[model samples]
Target chain A: MPTDFELTIRPRKGWQAVDFTEAYLYRELFAFLVWRDVKIRYRQTLLGGLWAILQPFIAMLIFSFIFNRLAHVQSDGPPYKLFAYAGLAPWTFFSTSVTQSSNSLLANHQLVSKVYFPRIFIPLGAIGALLLDLLLSLGLFFAMMLYYRWPATVALLWLPLFILVAVLATAGTGLTLSALNVSFRDVKYVVPFLVQMGLFVTPVIYPARYVPARWQVLLGLNPMAGVVIGFRHALLGTPASWAVMGVSIGVSVALFVFGLLIFRRMENRFADII
Target chain B: MKPILEIRELSKQYKLGWQRLRKAQNVRELIADGLTKPLRMLRGNQNHGPAKQEPFTLWALEKVNLDIYEGDIIGIIGRNGAGKSTLLKILSRITSPSNGTVVIRGRLASLLEVGTGFHPELTGKENIFLNGAILGMRRAEIIRRFDEIVAFAEVEKFLDTPVKHYSSGMYVRLAFAVAAHLDPEILVVDEVLAVGDLSFQKKCLGKMGEVSRSGRTVLFVSHNMAAIENLCTRGIVLHQGKLHFDGATKDAIQYYLNSLSTRFGTGHVVDLDGVGDRRSIVAPLLKRLEFFTENEQPLLEGLPTGSKLKIRVHFDLPGPTLSFNVGLGFNNSYGQRVFTAHSMFEPNRSVKESVGPQVFTCEIPSFTLMPGEYSVKVFLELKNREADAIEDAAKISVLESDFYGTGKVPKNGMFVLEHGWYLEQAADAK
Candidate 1:
């Protein structure tokens, strides 16, 4: 028999039990969800899983042409392809996660109002697909790094922590928007605009050094700001800063916690309102 | 011994719309009473609940409390929105209660929807693994019962086929197969068996009975009384989100049926409580519902075993006919509609047309229904046939006796037939 119990590691009243162990136990399911998301994305189409690889690659090419050629945007040291691909890595993950997770609730509305599961799974599943796509795109990033003849550094070891930070940031934003999407209903339309606006507000096309030091911490609070900076430092041989990574991790965790609390509080109202 | 589940003082209160409306109404009452009228003035103009205002709010489920011991098969019975599904959802931990503490122990799994978590792009075999994992089953256990699940769902041939390619029936079959095989200490299901025709229903019900007999706790929600009566040892009746009755299965069913009769006197519906003061209630009953026989005959006496009895409920709505569904059930001498059919899910009709009144009929080709005393119960729905339910416009019957002796004829079929004219033409017979 399956285990009947999955207690939250720490369940507080009004607290959303992230149920990490429950999530961990459900890890196989999570992986399958990622796989299913990949399959579903390309299942019935003329252009199948290619969309996963094409989405970020095409976006990178456009940004490379427009910003690198037309705008002559600064890439600290590496080639424009390397610069754009690095930014595309996490940005693609973040943007797609937000898109999928937000729509996840409405898409799974049939499952949501009928059966029960950790609702966080909805956004998590949405992100799961993004992560799969990210992994696929990462393959291209590796091929480019080799073409540029940039030897990997130990800083690359720190990449996992930065990805974790990206996940937290993505989850934090996704949770807020998903729950909101169920309510105001218009968040469905607004999320795309915000994501588009975010591509600019973030330093995806530019370097972090361009921003004055006085504004570093505030930018760090953007959460993904540190992530892009961390990725550049890790694979591109840029200098890493302990202060920035620490501050960003702290902000990411805070966003995650805050997002979780608000989601649990509002989730009770979802079935009725949605 | 601890009951498998316990619910105490559970009450869920919902805001109809604007909090301001409730506040304004409260202020009106306070100023009239002259008690705490000053306090009402201080908290002025703030919305108490939602941002919008509506005339009324439905209490889906009110203060309800109950406990279930381990190994109890409890059936929840009620009309569409009477909170049967609400209670199951709360129990399944899908949604939290606005007010109430539910203490449940042991592992929980839900057949609430077969393949609820199934992904369309995943193949049949992959979905089994996916389903088991989601239900908290370990890989080893799922593998052990892998063949059993596939054989039961009867989709072994399409194990590798993407579920998106499967027909609706195949989807349900595979989904139900996985849910049934994944063993859990407690299993919760809600009307999934209603899919895949009645033959499949009996097969699934048999599986549930087997699960129940194995000492696992089962919580079921369904409007089908015959299925409930056959499968559940205990009954729970939820009306307007409150527990109206909780006891023997027979008693709970009786309570539910009686309530329907009281609110809808015989078949007349439209109980206006209007004090004869309003212009007219329009009694949305007779204008929408009626009974007929297969040969275009109006129903007078109960149809014989081989005759089809049709129920046509005609409704004229404020908008085009979005959906017109009528549910008919076979009620025994005890006044219960045992086996019910609905037009809301007609196999060959356009379920989505528009808004308005339309004539909906459930045609039983030859009421292969048992030869027991049966009544025809009619229910009309609009938005989602189940959501927009009209329980009043049904017909009662003092059906013909068991001439074919097929009533209560064991747990085997969706219909009962009065077989006649058995013959064989062969040279050996001469």
Candidate 2:
């Protein structure tokens, strides 16, 4: 037999690093899974991709009415509608990615149990699907910026970096939760509550300036806090907070690494447990 | 020739009662359970109670060492829970083995289930790519063979339609077509041909034969004896998590059959649960088989020729009642099926649609089989699908008798047909 490719199988011992090369080899499958998720999300729906825009758009409306109109929450600079939307768009992306990817293994139990691929792709593909929705909601944010006559600024170049931070944070939390969700189904019930509570803890509805100055550092630990503030600074020319961004980026990277470790440790048992 | 795959001391242990024990009522209890896990491990033997006589762990597979060479089509056969699937899973890397190691020298692809990653909402074209990629084909390869796959499945016209709308036949065809096109150095398949229609099954068997002929190694697990005997060059029988026999396909099949008869001893009433040669996707539905005389008494002595015979089959049906058929096949000592009596043959005799344990008795007014040993095969079908089939379920000896109420008897054929010969003169003879 030709010995071009050799594979060794044995009991995995202790903690192992994620097999990035194996995942890379199955990149086509990962891409297909992401495509499938994106296609299935919109297929047969009355409103197709509009659901992406409508999710955050509707949330922004509700938050503006309650938090801005009634409570008179501070926006820091831009109109509360645009400011709230800048935060809501990425928040929607983060929350939905977390929820969907957390359940990805359970939902595709057949795939996980029957086929061999980098199981991490199951959750990562789910996050990849929501990236399109993030883009869609960002389109609505750009339109809102136009309506509010917010001129373009070079700070907009930082938008991708902020988006990368959000992706990292989502991947970190989603991978950890998805892996845990395989063994302990209680993660399913806990995730929604966590995401719901997450919105208040992060600065999705109000500016980080509204919080006490001392606790602002704690708020940056949430990762999405810095993402929301960064989105406003990038899109609406609001003053950027490098310290909070540094802390959030650091937290996001740490979470991502921690999540990968957990995922790699638990992935071997996923097929049996799931 | 050097073997393409080598496995040494492969074993897998599953925690049997852990899922039940892990059923924590709430978060606090779950946390407490986690905290006390190490302590409980330390006190393991002391915690064993009378009610927990069964061990908490099950060894699904023991030290199974195997070496498979290239171009060998090996049929892995055993009863249900015989570690066929566990071995395949370990080879496919779907689950890790608890002990030992396996080394493979070439690319391997395993098809445990067809249409595994197929999304009902995805179009046929989309599913083809998705399923192909899931089966470990590169996108470029799928793109190159896209047309061939579509044509082979005969779904060219509906390639853009969602798979949910495709007929069951169409779906299976498309799925198999994609799988058939996969060209891996080593391929492992389990029971996938059990789906689809008979003709499609034939086509799939043909495809498998072609694949084996092309010199790629194939490992197949199946309950269909004929397919295994026809397609495999070698066979491996796993009995109760250990490698029982491994040799040429013919010897392996004989070994499996012999082992099965001994495992479930011959008797008037045989429990079907332990019967090895069953082809059923569902759980053990046909529970037992009992043989009786004309008057429903258990037959102890050999059945005399021309005497009435009755066979009773006991089965349990779970869930709502559906249309089903039971059949009994009589095969001579040579393994040639002489005749079959199927419930579907007499459609007017509707079966009672009651749930749970039920008995169906079939009676023949005159036993016509020539005095010889014949094996009885029982099968049950639910909605035209093979729910359960057990070959050589029971054996009966037919005693020689005056079948025609004459002194002479025919001894050559398997069956005796009633006939009268009259001396007649043809025109030329007259």
Candidate 3:
């Protein structure tokens, strides 16, 4: 099974260079790492896979009570509980992915120092593991929708697009913070705060409609804002702000590309520094 | 076949010490540094202070060039910090070199350490696939060989159990089995073979032998001289970040040993800091080791073959003093241990703390070594626990001298024994 792969080693190139081909060659490694991450996450726990659903479901309950019951907030859809859970789903996925992926490199520093892989795979695998949790929790989201007598809309076909954008956003930020964590350990302390702060900015507890109309497009630049809004539109059949989604898609793509370049630039020094 | 790997002028420099902090920047400055630097560069207003270079750097490898062909098992031998691992790291692409290039043909995999990506929570079977894929094995390939790998590791019964529960020996075996089964054209192995029991080490060596015989080139780095001699046909010796020798295994080992011995023979008292082979089982108690004449003067140059020689060793004991023995090994220039003498065989000599720094002196009455270059190795053992051992601790050249009254002396053999030969009438041929 010898493919036409010839490895040439030279002095490191400029910061913009990344070796997608080499990463492609180790595609099996990526898959195995992802599998290992997913397996190890739920191993030896009592709740096991159910924790994925329980975490977001419980958070949805608390948020629905606090905002809808106590604060008497006006959510986009009719039932505030359904609206809050829908936004919590993607927001939870993004926050968890960012937090775990940021620490993935430090947790696997032993492997980083001992072996050679793309290094990107560690964080990518972290994201992959959280993605499984997101899917598992989505089942509960649909159950909640059914409980609320929400109609199944044809717009649900576009759900995968919003998920992709969410992944792109998570990966982009994850890779950048993870690479920075290697050199400046302060990134570790910053990640939790970033994730916590991201919740308020992502329009997860409330609808994006609560944000001022003039600031709505600017909120799309947060990437997760657009994803949460898009998820509501697809599932609840709310007319989506196409302009905001467009800005979000563009910002997510840009972040992903730039994150990859920074990750590759910092990669060569990882074995030495980490 | 073309060389499986060609390394040319490969060098790696490592910065040492704590890095100095630069001017603290606010988020505004940080964003400007990342995003707008290119546009600002066009306006030519990018005035900046000269960059402060690192004060010190240690070159781990300097201009090292090596070519490894198919089926070649080259043993890399070096003292600690000799750049053997650095060379392998460069070859494996674990780290990029500071200078030069390496052209590698065919698929290559490196076992810098066994079980590189093994997750403790994963089962043995799961880890086999995970580690295999990490080492570049395809999923189908791992599936095809999964049973073989398990059988080889002798962990078949524990396949479903997490690797964290596996005993260290079982863990190492399972890790090695996955690595050894990788079907790469070139394999780079480090000193991870030092793990496991002796029998398992032999088994791993046998597997490596099979790998090389199957037409794969292997670069093996190890400090075990016997293992190197037994396995590698070619040898490379690295000294202080440079390629010291590259030749036949026999010659390379001899050259490395000679260099160690010569460094020890410089006559000045050797301060025991990073001295001797790190692989020695000794616990490093030697503070100052030296050789002297009977008059306590430092022995320099050559001594007569039949002269009295005295060796003094000074050692510091960090813990409470115990009854210890000072053992010395004398080897001829060919790196063969001619004889070993231990103070345990002698009476009334116990290294005690009351003596301050423990000093032990051994005197040889009429040293019978033949006229040749020789080296000394010293070992300190207390209660049968080896405290320190320095191989090639000192070297002494022996000049020709006549021990017998006869005008002629025999020119062959290592030493002479005092004896009398009586002429007797030979029995009739049967």
Instruction: Order the candidates by DockQ, highest first.
Output: 2, 3, 1
lDDT of each: 0.71, 0.86, 0.82
Whole-model lDDT, candidate 3? 0.82
Give per-residue CA lDDT, model 2, range A1-274, as digits (tens): 1236778899986799878888878888889999999999989999999999999999889999999999999788889898889889889999999999999999999999999988999999999999999998888888887899978789999999999999999999999999999877889899999999999998888788878888878878989889888988898888867888889999999999999999999998988878
Q: Report the candidate with higher lDDT, 2 versus 3.
A: 2
**What range of 10 consecutive residues in model 1 chain B has the weakest lDDT sum?**
B274-283
- In candidate 3, which residue pairs get closer than 3 Å at backbone N, Cα or C atoms, i.e. clash? B283-B387
Candidate 3 recovers a fraction of native contacts equal to: 0.79
Provide the clashing-pair count of each candidate structure: 20, 0, 1
> What RMSD value applies to candidate 2?
10.3
- The positional error of residue A51 in candidate 2, measured at the CA in angstroms, is 0.8
lDDT of 1 by residue, B225-261 (tens): 8888998999988876778899999999999888765
Off by over 4 Å in 2: A1-3, B19-55, B269-296, B299-430
True-structure RMSD, every candidate: 8.8, 10.3, 13.3
lDDT of 3 by residue, B158-248 (tens): 9999999999999999999999899988889988777788789999999988987887888888867888898898999998688999999
lDDT, residue B334, model 1 = 33
